[model samples]
Target chain A: MTAPAAPQTAPSPAAAPAGAPAVIRAIHLSKVYELGAQQVRALDDVSLEIGKGEYVAIMGPSGSGKSTLMNVLGCLDVPSSGEYWLRGQEVSKLSEDELAEIRNREIGFVFQTFHLLARQTALRNVELPLVYGAVRADERRARALELLRQVGLEKRADHKPNELSGGERQRVAIARALVNRPALLLADEPTGNLDSRTGKEILELLDRLHGEGHTILLVTHDPEVGRRAARTVRVRDGRIESDAPNR
Target chain B: MIALLEGVRIALQAIWGQKLRSALTLLCVIIAILSIIAVVSVLDGMDLYVREEVAGAGANVFTLRRVDELKVLTDLQVFLDSLGNPRITLADWKALRAEMTLAEFVDPLRSRSGDLQAVRDGRSIRNVDLQGRGAEYPGIEDLDLERGRHLTQADIDQRREVLVIGAQVAETLFPGVDPLGQKVRLSGRHYEVVGVFARRSNVLGQDRNIFAILPLSALFAQFGSFRSISVQVKAKSLGDFAAALDEARTIMRVRHGLRPQDPDDFNLTTAEQFLTLWEKISSGIFATLIGVVSITLVVGGIIIMNVMLVSVTERTREVGLRKALGARRGMILFQFLVESVTLTSVGGVVGIVLGFAAAFLIGAFSPLPYSVKPWSIVSALVIVFAVGVFFGLYPASRAARLQPVEALRRE
Candidate 1:
């Protein structure tokens, strides 16, 4: 299978204006995993470009390269080979510290599992990113409350993850991801753990956020979810099958 | 500062969440620290008391004997060689008293066995150390008299049957009535209780209130041979104390010795010499106790480290989330370190207060000299804090080095 084509769109506002064509540009990105001497190619030379303010959905079957690609894009893993530039900074070759700084300043992640700190209140969970960014206490608290209010969790701000419903917890997670006002919001099956009605609510919230000009990348196996994005990319057997604008 | 405060808030929240486990862990640290502080404070207090008592008794007076006088060296050979056949007799005292100009008083002491019965309203006391000395004994030693007259020259010269009873003896024999001029039977001999001596103060271990004194000549006639004699002297000034000691030594050597090469006999002890010996013994005991206490503190520090390691492991997912959000490894390290240190420091403060309470209780009820030094409290705090930092480093580093992916995977 050949690598996928680069994402096509105009430059995003969050991206640097210093001659950068896209917010994220991946060329021949590949990741290989060795499990007990069994070699598995998770991502086979995937190349893609995602412009600023673009809402893209990545869909694939089980064992497809979507998760690996997401890991690479989020700077949580280094590609086995190839160049990946985040906002014109070559993230593939960045040091661990540099990668951490970029992760703090450029990307926000929403996991399939709400992943809120069980011991912390919703407000504290949202403040986690600002803590990493070394934001002052007064500013961190004020901004965290603002994000909680944005997610309509102001009344439930003091409740812990276990005290909240799946939908509310996910909303708190979303609030946490957007607290630092990151360049991109990367959501991996954000609604996977919720009921259908709660999942619809989450999708509606993401749809609202995208409409409000937030750059979003959604990874899912569901076609209905994919159709909501501005563009959809399909992957199979460690390669992209198609990349096109959604109807 | 904000980061530190955030770290503190997070740590408190985590500890509050696991209340039982955290309290149990803190209990271990508190016991360890308490043990150390208690032992050190008591020892420090005892040392101070010993020094003060010894110094008050005398610090400039040095005893001189034909042999080494301070009891620092105690061998059979030294003792035998030091105490030769030449005893400090009455004639020797007379010669030394006349020859030594710096000698304040040369009082020859002799012990006698005499059963005294002071019949007041029918009760009598027994078994007192009946001591006898010359007329100069009370003046040279500065003995305190509670009532009645001391031994006079006429009493010694005329060999009068008179006596002075210590406070304990007076209380026992006389009860409510005064014992002065009352006749006491001693070794089947009758002697009048001429005076009641005051109770000795600030003395350790022995009761000075169970004794009686008589004139030296009278005691010899009544009982007989004495083995030892102590010569008490007060120098003209502090600067002349050494010179007076030297003069007394020369006179004693001349009166007791045969040839120029022969060593004299007798052990002379001054208040200063006794004080030094007491300090040496007390310091050795204090050092040994401090060593054992320090071991407990070390064990406590190790327990803190172990608990912190467990905490770091339990919070792996939380750490991962923070890291993914943008926390640097240094921030992670700092947060964990602060938590561990805060735990130990709190335990230390509690331990110190507990130590002071223990010391106070001991001082109130027991004769053991217990005083808490301010520096000791400060030292305890500093040492415990250092222990927290030392033990916390490994676990904190482990947390800081955790990979976001691996940590999240653990969850």
Candidate 2:
């Protein structure tokens, strides 16, 4: 057989415009949690770059480093070793207050459990991030309502979390995540608690958001969910196994 | 402002969510505030009643008497006697009226008790104590006569057998008989009842309404001796009352042969003095009761802290979620603190209402004096708020220091 020719490179029309910054960059990041006598290396020597407006999924099995990486990216916790630069800010070195500001202004988080405040209405849940942002009351209400409308939850805005169905509650959480108009949307198993059909709908909604130039980072264990992303990163036993374009 | 309102809203919602626990927690604060209010109200009412009694007794009157520090000491008595006795007498009263430029009137009174009897239409009354006085007695003392006339100078000069029976005596000896102008036999002698004196309400447990008033000559004739005499002096104006008293004292000292350095050998009791005594007694009770109530409040505060600590543990996941959603430590601390204060303040308000109701019921139906003071209510509120803040600090700090990841993993 003839030796395979070198793969041809094609000029792509969808390439990022010049000078667009990477939305997230992690360099040699590591997280070690000490539990009594033993230490857990949740993330070890992880380095990744996600460009602006990219939809990326982190796929891993249980005990993998995916959740640790998500937490570091979301500024919820600092890496034990190395730097995380989120939108040009050294988030790993930031003070807790600064990290909170970044979390409020830059990253929107959607958890798998849909952690909505139980006593608060869907509209109030959406307004919570604005409360932390110190937005004026009227503006917070208006923006929260608009975000709930964007998630197709305007009619259910007055319903409390316990009163909402699983899909509707997840949608309220999504609206809450987007209420601050964050630059990056981070979802950790956003469809883990949903029916397959509802999960597909959520993925479609996220895809539409990505099409509108929103940067999205989704952590999941399902191959189907990973395939929907433009890029897929696989983690196992605290290390990334492979990273490649999803197509 | 919005943050504060939101804090309050969330705090109230949390309290509402755990209604039974909230009510139980609030009970401690309520009891503390109620204790404070009850004590304060009773003291206030007692003070008011004492002040009214003293003012009614005499606002501008002062009595001067000898003060001996040693009990049963002959030297003090000899010294008091050598000072020539500042005991008020009729001559001293005349001198006081003459020399005191500020004196409006003066009267010397000597009390004498005897087995006096009054009979009307075959009914008889006994055991009356008689107070004999000059014509200035009515104006010098606060006595209201309901019928006929009081003793005049002519009555004393002629030794007329006229008497002013007190309301109790009149009611007893001549019930439905109109004691005015009626004849009543006293100590084997008959005296016409010229007037019936109105009842004098008791002060500090002494009833003035059970005695009879007779002319000074008649009491002297009946008793044959006087142990002590009281001088009542009136001043033209309140500003001059003290000056008039001083002038009367000087005139009495000169008449009684007292040295300039010798202190008056008589008791001087003024309305102001009685008020000071009353306040001292009431405030001592107040201090003791407040000390006990303070201990209760401290206990209440500790209970609040313990409950809040448990709350922090119970809601660890909620705290983690809040921290993960960009909540600062200060925000977490403030939310918890607001909840504590809200709980305490609600308890305080309830306590105040209950305290007032209790006080009103006591005041209306019982003999124990009770009146709630506005300042006490305000102070109780402040104390409750302070206690809440003080006790809430530790639990709030613990909540704020919780790591989001650790709290999330706490199941």
Candidate 3:
């Protein structure tokens, strides 16, 4: 258990206007996973557009393919058919290594499980993305320390994941996600494992990041969580049911 | 280089995490390398010792004896057959000395070795090696005198009962006093000491300076002339050696009157032949041992491969996470390869140290000397490093080829 960190100065917002061009454009994207003799449509003809500095949530029930949609959007899995263009680059047909490079430079992922490496300290976890980016050691440390400070975890930088509480771990994950300064921040059920009080705190942290003009695409099944986003897209049976603003 | 360092750091953590398993794997590698190092070191030491101390004094010299060959000691039938060969006598020595153009010296020597005693001033030394040599024996062998003189042609012609004593014999009988002109009793007869040979250290752990020598004629007068003798012959130079041997062999065959198709009745032992025989024996042993150690090393390598496979399986999710973080397949492969190399190299170093200790202990307690050859150390390290790379390839590539999404999805 640890005391909550003091709030620091707010992070600068992303430099994109309200009517900026799209950051991600999925045109007729379909993902079909083959299991033995059966083919499951994980994503079916999904067409969507997300501009820079927008906070959007894709919501659905179990088996509705929201996770698959998030994976495709995060460049983790390729769609079976479609033209997926990210920042004017057609990436749906990219090679494995090239996609990995795209994921490192253009997208940041925050998993539901808070997937922090168990052995490393919080500071090292925050520095993980920068390490893959081939950042120099001194610069990597300084950037990681600054991100930790932004997440109000500078005082706990040396603590491993097992020593931190659930909320602190999620905060460390958020710090790691932003360390690369990616174009899109994609989180899957970011507050799924926290209590109501801690969950609210994480939600507030997400809201603060969104307010800073960061492009946030969150995936969840809970409507109350979806209601926090500025825009919501509903999916059912691998197809979008509705796309609308929260108001 | 960064990947190499990180790979080593990760490997150490993994090894430390599984202490007993890593230790057992390392032990297997150590034993395999230790046997090779120890055996090579002993062989190297013995080769040098035999060449310098044992065979060096007899360089350019060869011996003609009644026995057919040195290998007669290994076969009973050969020994029995050679027993019927005529004794090498003074006649053969004289013929070779007079007829050979390539010959430097020809000396006849007869040895008596069982339960001989030398007594001087009532002080006795038992089991003394007693030998009789012709006047030119010193010229054919490294028989330097500590004082006085060697046997002269006059001593042999007059049949004088004069002796030359080894340093050990002199020490035991004369102690602090001068041995020159002193009388020592041997075989119920007294002989005046004319010379004393300088002290010599042991060869193959057996002392050399424990013998007494007498003039050939005087020895025949006392012990009769029926004993088997060896004719030692030296060539003028290395160029003359082969021709000298051929000439001596032809002369002896003519003297014995052997038929054209018949084998020679006597044996010839040269310094080169003795060294070659030793090399054949030592190399035979080394080849068999190396074959065995190679199998052990391969087994050790298999163990490493198995352990690495287990490690990759255990860390599948971590590999997925690393891949997700943008680590390429080559990076993953390099990391695991570095790990395996570090493991085997560590084992190689430990084995060399332990092998050196084992060699030193054996040399200290026994007659076989020990030397650590630089090439052996280099070869041992190279062998283990190659094992690591060869065995580690499959597991590392398996780890590298893992699909990132599937690996990450695995619980």
Candidate 4:
């Protein structure tokens, strides 16, 4: 394990005020995937908006189009038709390169599988986003270190995914997602692979990050994870069912 | 770029994770490059050895003979035709020497009197390559004497029983005593030792030194008339070699009374002919080598492409994750190329090292002075990289073109 590095001086993009401009706005968006015989509408006629300081949970059971919605929102996929705006940009119409840039600069994702590169250590995993961002090596190291410290995994910076516990690996994943200081932290089933107690610990960490004013879009089927968010949007059979405040 | 460094890192990790697969993919390249480097190294060494040997004797020197060796190799008709041609006799050598104007020296020589054995005080040197030559033979060849002197014109004309022994012959005949002014028996006849030629380079073979020289008069007197005699001719200057060859050919033709339509009965070949013969032989070998090695490399490349396709398929989720994390298609493509290239480049390096070692071992045990050319090494490396990129293209593009959402959704 390498020595714990000094923290980054660049502040995280987590200081949005309430009622700030909406960072994600979708208007009647749809996504269709063609199978051999059937046309699978993974997302259909969904309209939604997420503000800069909002903590929103998108919930749906398996094959409910919730994953597709998260993918589209994270700039990993574009809608088949309809306008989708991310941070005032029409993301639905963006080219692959532009979408990649948006994903690098504006969206940070934590996947259900942890998605940490198996060969890389915790520090290198966190440094990945900055590498895509073309950040200098020294700054990448410092920022990844700061994110690791923030996630309380500073001492485990050099530990590979296999060496870390499930919850600890998720923490490292969280640090990796935050390394670029992206405006949107999009997590897909952040606790799907963790035990109930570890799941709660991950939720508490998300809660603390939300308290710091970071915009979060959590995708999960679990009601417990949804309840932790300020708002919940439920989807079923490729269409939005309800959008309501958690209170 | 950071992308390149990261790509290399990813490739190395991929290779480490699947060593057996990578080694299997690299097998063809290794074998192909190894054989090429080894053969080319030995061949190149031999080439240098021949060229140096020829150049030492002087490139402008040529032998006038009854049959050309290259003609025997390249033409079936010439082989039959040359066999019927008249043996160039002492009379012909005398005529050419008297008539030639451009030649600096025209020295007649005769060999293959392999039956002759030299003895001094009952210490005989057997298996000697005894050559009978005119006095000017020393001028046309690189014969440097260590003691006494070459047989002079007076010695050749007066038919003195004078002999110039090879270093090997002198060593065997005179052991501890100076060979100069000593008497040796040749074909049961006594002859005075005129000179001892310097030890020749043993690069080709040590057997080159086991020879003795006798004046044509003395040899003819002792061994009777020879079958055919060859004359060594040297140009006045290196630049006048063509002119000298033309003059000699024209003189010989006029003397033989040959018509312009008829091919000359005598063969004219220069030291360069030896080098050219080697080149012809090696080029045939080289072409066949290229054919086999290229097929192996191409087949290896195809296998690598197949393996890369499998690798890309296996890493769909990882690709998707990287794409979602902001890796562009170009980055994905470049990373895979780096992987393929690293695999083959590593093989190329190993093969080259093995080739050098093999060449060294072969040269050590044999008379071959094996050496590797720098450009062959460079070209082999370039070939490795080129093959990798060419073969890696399809698989890398396949990985690059994947939609992140689709890829991420793969179970």
**Model 2 chain A weakest 10-residue run by lDDT:** A1-10
Off by over 4 Å in 3: A1-21, A235-237, B1-5, B12-28, B71-86, B118-132, B143-199, B204-228, B257-265
Q: List the residue pairs that clash in candidate 2.
A: B63-B267, B63-B268, B64-B266, B64-B267, B65-B265, B65-B266, B65-B267, B66-B265, B66-B266
TM-score of each: 0.87, 0.81, 0.84, 0.86
Runs of candidate 4 exceeding 4 Å displacement: A1-21, B12-35, B116-127, B158-162, B169-194, B203-206, B221-223, B259-262, B273-278, B290-315, B346-365, B409-411
The TM-score between candidate 3 and the true structure equals 0.84
- Candidate 3 lDDT for residue B15: 79
Question: Which is superior by TM-score, 3 or 4?
Answer: 4
For residues B126-215, write the lDDT of model 2, one tens digit per residue.
557788887877876778998888999999888788998888888877878788888888778888999988887654345567778888
The candidates, ranked best first by lDDT, are 4, 3, 2, 1
- lDDT by residue for model 4 over B45-119, one digit each (tens)? 877877777554678888889887678677779877898888888988888788888888999888754533345
Q: Write the per-residue lDDT of candidate 1 for residues B1-411, one digit (tens) a residue.
A: 555666777877776777887787778678777777777777777677667764554444444333454543435677666655455667766776677777666666665555567544546666688877778776455468999989988988888889888998888888778889898887777888899989874334457688898877777777665555544565556787788877877777666654778655665667666566767777788788878878887888788899889999999987887777777787788888887788888888988888788877876766665777788889888988898889999999999899887787686
Of candidate 1 chain A, the 10-residue stretch with the lowest lDDT total is: A1-10
lDDT of 3 by residue, B1-411 (tens): 544455566667777778898888889889988877888888788888888877887888999999846565346787688889998888888899899999899888888752333455587777888888888888887878999999999998899999898999888888899999988887788889999999986766787988988888888898899977899999999789999999999999999999899888898889887887778887887788788878989998999999999989988887887777666777778778877877788888999899888989888888778888889999999999999999989999999898877787788
lDDT of 3 at A120: 84
- The DockQ for candidate 2, computed on C-alphas, is 0.43
Which of candidates 2 and 4 reaches a greater lDDT? Answer: 4
Against the true structure, what is model 4's DockQ?
Answer: 0.58
| Candidate 2 residue-wise lDDT, A135-235, digit = tens | 99899999999999988989998999999988888889888888898989999999999999999989998998888888899999999998899888888
Candidate 1 — which pairs collide? Answer: A7-A49, A12-A52, B115-B186, B115-B187
- lDDT of candidate model 3 versus the reference: 0.84
